[model samples]
Target: MRLSLAIAMAEEKVKEGGKNKMSDKKWFNKGAKAGKVEKREKLLKTYEKAIEVISKYAVTLFIKGFELSELGRHKKALKIYKKIIKLFPQLNVAWFYKGFELSKLGRHKKALKAYEKAIEIDPQYAEAWSNKGVALSELGRHKDALKAHKKAIEIDPKNALAYTNLGELFFKLGNLKKASENVEKALKIESDLVPALNLQGRIKIEEKAYDAASESFKQAMSLDGANPVHFLWDTYTNYLKIGFNLDSEDKKYQEEIATIIRNLEKMNETLSKNQKQEKEMRAYVLYFLGHFYLKSNDILTAKEKLEECIKLKSKSSIKASARELLGNIWNYRIKPPWWRWWLNSPLYRWPKRFGFSILLLLISALLLLHPFIPGWFPLLQINWSLYAFLIVLLIIILFLPNIKRIQIKGIEVELQSPPPYEPVLSPTVMEEIMKEIEAKYTKLE
Candidate 1:
């Protein structure tokens, strides 16, 4: 019986030991699971913090890039944007800014790709779409540009920039009416938008509405005080358009010319110091000022300005224009050759100036010399001298004023043809020129 009890005790001990082993295994598994959960939570927290730090760094870099762009360091800005893109490939704004810098650098094709990437990342990127339209326009894909602008407008109905861009495109296409309508819409949406105001002014100038165009440019100048040179230049040129059409002797003609000079001076003052230092800008200013003075018959002042412009190292085209105007002035200053003096001589007026005196002298000479003259001479035929005198006297009385009138008319006509310089503001030429200027100088929307 003792042996059986011992065996039973051993069996009990074995069962208890098995149960302990199972319990130990369950506790170890539970602890291991808790430790794994803790580790996973810590990893997730670390990941979230890392993302937060990267996002903050990206924002900082973006601001730096924008500041560089504002300073006109587009190449440097491009590098910053590229770095941002490398870090955060999904950032649409980074892509858009990359495109902006590229456009500023005149790489429109590359800019178009960057803008497309931004749009692909975020289809509702209105600014990207609008800028893409500009790239397309630069590429001469007008239809695609139009579609892109329209899409931008559809995406954001209040996109004044898109409207202005659309208007500019229409203007390029020679649809002045449509251009005006769209530009007007842009102005309505944002009354103080400088680009819209400037475009409106350009359209009115095309329509020959000088007064309205002046007002629009003036408004633009006021609103865009920091960059008023363009508006000021436009206003000056608009006055020039009016002045060129006016009779020099008109009471208001000198006043108009004076206004043009004042506007130009204001433009000079408005130019930034760096711009003032630009030989090209100074050449343009001097050339136009000289041109205006030349038109107003201020030969000395015109010669001075033109000479100054010619002496500067400027663009070939501006220098060429200056040289041409200078040549005109030189030709004008030279007295006509002796043979052509009759064109302006008192004798040219004939009967109006000296006919009566000459006829009397002739009659006296004939009376004095009649006795000495040959009898067969035609001068002694049938008292012909008296008839000649009477006819000459009649012509003097009847046609003197008419002759003076004709002389004045001829002077006016000559004055009209004196300025052979083709105006820089010829509609087609000015449109392209101003568009280029705006592209260069105007800030991005």
Candidate 2:
């Protein structure tokens, strides 16, 4: 009986051992599954962080490219934008900016392709559509350009740039009424839009509203204080056109011509170094100056300016115009006598500082000689002794330097006998003056 009991106990122990082993295998499988779940969660978190980092990097690169483009470094900007597109093919803004740079570089076909790619990525991109219209217009695909601009306006109802672009297109198509309407709509939406204002000025010029066009250009210049070259050129050309349209003997015609010449001289003084370096701008200015002088009957000055314009490597059209004007001067226009040329030269022209004094002196001399000359008109009688005192005072005024004080943007500037040929304050001088004023104020504060 004892042997049988001992065998039973051993069998029970073996069964318990098997049960424990099965439990151990189940725990091992559960632990392995939990470890795999944890590892997958870690990998997923890492991937999300990597994607976020890449997105931020792309945004940073895009901003850099945009800044470069704003600084007029389009080629460098294009490379940066291209790099971004290569790294992040899905970035739509990169493609859009790539198109902008390409358009600036005059590669309209490639710009169209880039813009199309952007539109494909984001169909709602209104800017892309509008700029694509610009490319199309430049390519002479006017119908397609119109469609693109309309689509942009449809996508974003208040897109002022798109409206302005549409206005420009209509102007090209000779639909002045439609062009004016769209430009007005654009101005209504964004009153300070410089391009819209410029377009408005151009339309006004076409409509023969000279005063209103002047106002529009002035507004544009005020709004675009940093770069008003386009507005200046437009205004100058419009004034020239007005002067040409009027009768040469009309008082208004002479006034208009004088205004243009004065403004051109002022522009020459204020031109930045960069602007002075622009051969095209210089050529245009010279051509217009020559044209103005020719109209004013100053043949010698006109010839000089036209000759200078022809010497510059400029646009074919401008050079051709200069050549034609020179031909007309040589072939058709009568040359003025040497004495008239001397009188019309810069030295004998009315001096800015002593012009009024000189006029007064001439009147006084006429009064002093009244007794010796035959009186053509008895109504011109005056007190001789009083006129002699006036003559002395006028002589003093003419010989003495004039002191003038002017306030510009809350800064007081003093002048003594300002130069007759140049503006008293040029752009470079104004900048320096502003800086000095700011520095002084900072010190005082």
Candidate 3:
């Protein structure tokens, strides 16, 4: 009986042990699931904080890049901006700024690509579209430039820069009337806009509205105090090309000349004060001064300045101009070849010039005299009509566009095409932006 009882008790103890093992397994699975849930919540919070930190860091980097760009350190700005773009490919503003810096460096083709990428990211970006137009214009693709400007205007009618770019394109196309109208629209939208003001001045000069053009230039200078050197250089080049008739002694003409000289003197003073002015810049000022004095009929001063320009020899075009002018001063005058002058002259009212009428008369006279002079009048039957034609051609050549006197005015000034303007974002604007960024960062903290 005792042996049977021991066996039964052992079986009951085994069943209780099996039940305890199953209960412990269930408790272990429940605790493991709860621990996993806690870990997932903590990881999610960490990612959120990381994203916030990254965003703040991006804003700070952008400000640094902007400050570098403002300081004319374009390559450094590009490095910072490229880093931002690599980390945040979706940031359209970063692409726009990259394009702007590229444009500043005169890498218009690369700038265009950057702008296109920005546009792809955000088609509604008006500044990007407008800047794309500028890039196209720089590439000499006027038709495409017009299309881009129109697109910007379509996206945002109030985009002043779009209108300014439109004006510039039309000016290039020689549609001065349309250029003026578009420039007017830009100025109306934003009167203090420097580019619009400068462009308006260009249009006014083309229209022969000298006073209006002068006012526009003065306004641009006032608005662009940060770069006085540019103002002086631009103003001098524009008026010099306007073909001012100094011999007329017109009051407006005198005042304009006086203003140019005064500005040149002021430029010298400014340069003397700022030793940072490069040797090339000083050479350019001398070249401009030479031309200014030449136009003012101060031949002695002009000769001195031009000689200095040749000595420096910084810019090839300026050096060439100085040499040519010096030769003219020495030789009384040195004219361009007749054929070149004719080709360079404006086609407007060309028929009214003496060359055209004289050619017509000589042709008529040759035809009338053709029969009177025999075909075989002289040796070996040289056609007399051919001789008459030759004589007429010789006479026509004599009257061809200032062949006798070297007129180095008007279309004769073959200056190099104007350098592209620098990027126009002001320090004040950047400072405001930095302030906004700091405010946002503090609020987030």
| Top candidate by TM-score | 1
- Residues 247-312, candidate 2, lDDT per residue (tens digit)? 769988888888888777566445435554445556666776777787778877887887878877
lDDT of 3: 0.65
lDDT of 2 at 96: 90
1-445 in candidate 3: lDDT tens per residue? 2222223333333445323333323333433444455565654444444345446656777988888876667899998889789758989989999998887777999999999999999999988898899889889988888899999999999978789888878987889989989988988999888878877876676566767777887887787765544364356444644445454266667567767777776775675465443445555566667766766777778767767667765533546655665656533432445543444322222653466567657767766776665664544566656787687665656554443333245545422232232212133432343233222121100
Residue ranges of candidate 2 with Cα displaced over 4 Å? 1-64, 67-73, 233-246, 275-277, 327-445
Q: Would you give me the overall lDDT of model 2?
A: 0.67
Candidate order, TM-score descending: 1, 2, 3
Note the Cα lDDT for every prediction shown: 0.70, 0.67, 0.65
- Candidate 3 clashes: the total is 0
lDDT tens string, model 1, 1-445? 2122223333333445323333323433433444454665654544444355446657778888988887778999999999889868999999999999999988999999999999999999999999999899989999999999999999998999899999989988989999999998998899999888888887887787877887888888788875644564565556556655887688688778777877766655444256634455666667778767766777778778878777776754667767776766654453344323323322233542365456456657655676656665755555667756766655444333323233344563222234565434355544554555566567767
Top-lDDT structure, candidate number: 1
Could you estimate the TM-score for every candidate? 0.65, 0.60, 0.59
Clashing pairs in 2: none
Q: TM-score of model 3 relative to the true fold?
A: 0.59
